[model samples]
Target: MHQPGTVSSSLHEHVQIGDTLLISAPAGMFTLDTTRTNPVAFIAGGIGLTPLLSMLQTVVKQQPERSAQLVYAVRDHHFHAFAEELQQLAAQNPAISHTIFYENGTEEDIEQKHCDYVGRITEAWLQQHIPADAEVYVCGPRPFMQAMISILLRKGITMENIHYEVFGPALAFSVD
Candidate 1:
């Protein structure tokens, strides 16, 4: 769960096993581009994985030929949600590759969590993992998205190939 003030936490705490709840429909311009066939690279942090997971699931069902990789970063091993399902999906599907990173994890933690990498996700690490020319989709904290975007730009990834979405409250910073 995220925390007290976050959407994920609120839903987790209030929602019951058999309870029915009403919610607004999903509405967001940030979404996967199904037309692109060049391969997809999903970089998600914390709860941002939700939307990307949906996209990945769609890719598996609708376009199984598409090659996709997911790089996920979470606070720790125990805190990662839907981990077992993600790992199993990756293991069973040849078209998908999944890697998990823990920001505050030890080697033991990595082993226990069944995650691939430790520490925070880095641009260099991403470069080595994702396929070249893969279309990138990033969603995470503001600092993470900003950092990843900067690194991606430095690596010569065109603006057209990179997409992003922000969750929670936005930070105040002048674009100019």
Candidate 2:
């Protein structure tokens, strides 16, 4: 668990260890809730997809029946890390659905059919994709997370159902 108000840059450090990049134990507030069988939705942006990947791995190993929908947003396909792996996971797990939203991509560039949505995800996009009563987990840049949270609130999602994880130092965004 991350200490509230104590921002650390080392928490986001990535190192190459031989053939693999050694990622630290996902240090964030958001964790997969195995107890709940309700529909779960994950909103991740850029490198914020790390913890969500861990959650998905854990889910595949421990609780495979949990229904999940992951909406990942990135700048482009080349910048989208772990694309192949996520697609494979989604295909193997019947209960899991994954979608990618690329800021600079077309429908033909993506691997999965109807799984790619262009541009940033809005409240209307979320309302169309996610169920009315689903547990939503969001992790990304401060602006992206804030926007998603605002949309969720406007859609009448309870505060308890909306969880968030911030990576690295806290970002100070000017809302004005």
Best candidate, TM-score: 1
In model 1, which range of ten residues has the least summed lDDT?
167-176
Cα RMSD to the true fold for all candidates: 4.5, 6.7
Over the stretch 1-176, how does candidate 2's per-residue lDDT look in tens digits?
55543334434453334556445544455777878888888889887888888887777778788888888998887789788789899989999989888888777765544337777787778878888788888888778888887888777888788888866554433322
Indicate the worst ten consecutive residues by lDDT in candidate 2: 167-176
Q: Could you tell me how far off, in angstroms, the CA of residue 11 lies in candidate 1 after the best superposition?
A: 9.0
If scored against the real structure, what TM-score would every candidate get?
0.79, 0.76
Deviation in Å, model 1, residue 85 alpha carbon? 1.4
lDDT, candidate 1, 1-176, per-residue tens: 55544776777988889999876543334778888899898888888888889888988877788999988899887778788779877887898988898888789876675677778888789667766688888887777777776777667777678787755444332221
Those runs of model 2 whose alpha carbons end farther than 4 Å from true positions after fitting are 1-28, 110-115, 169-176
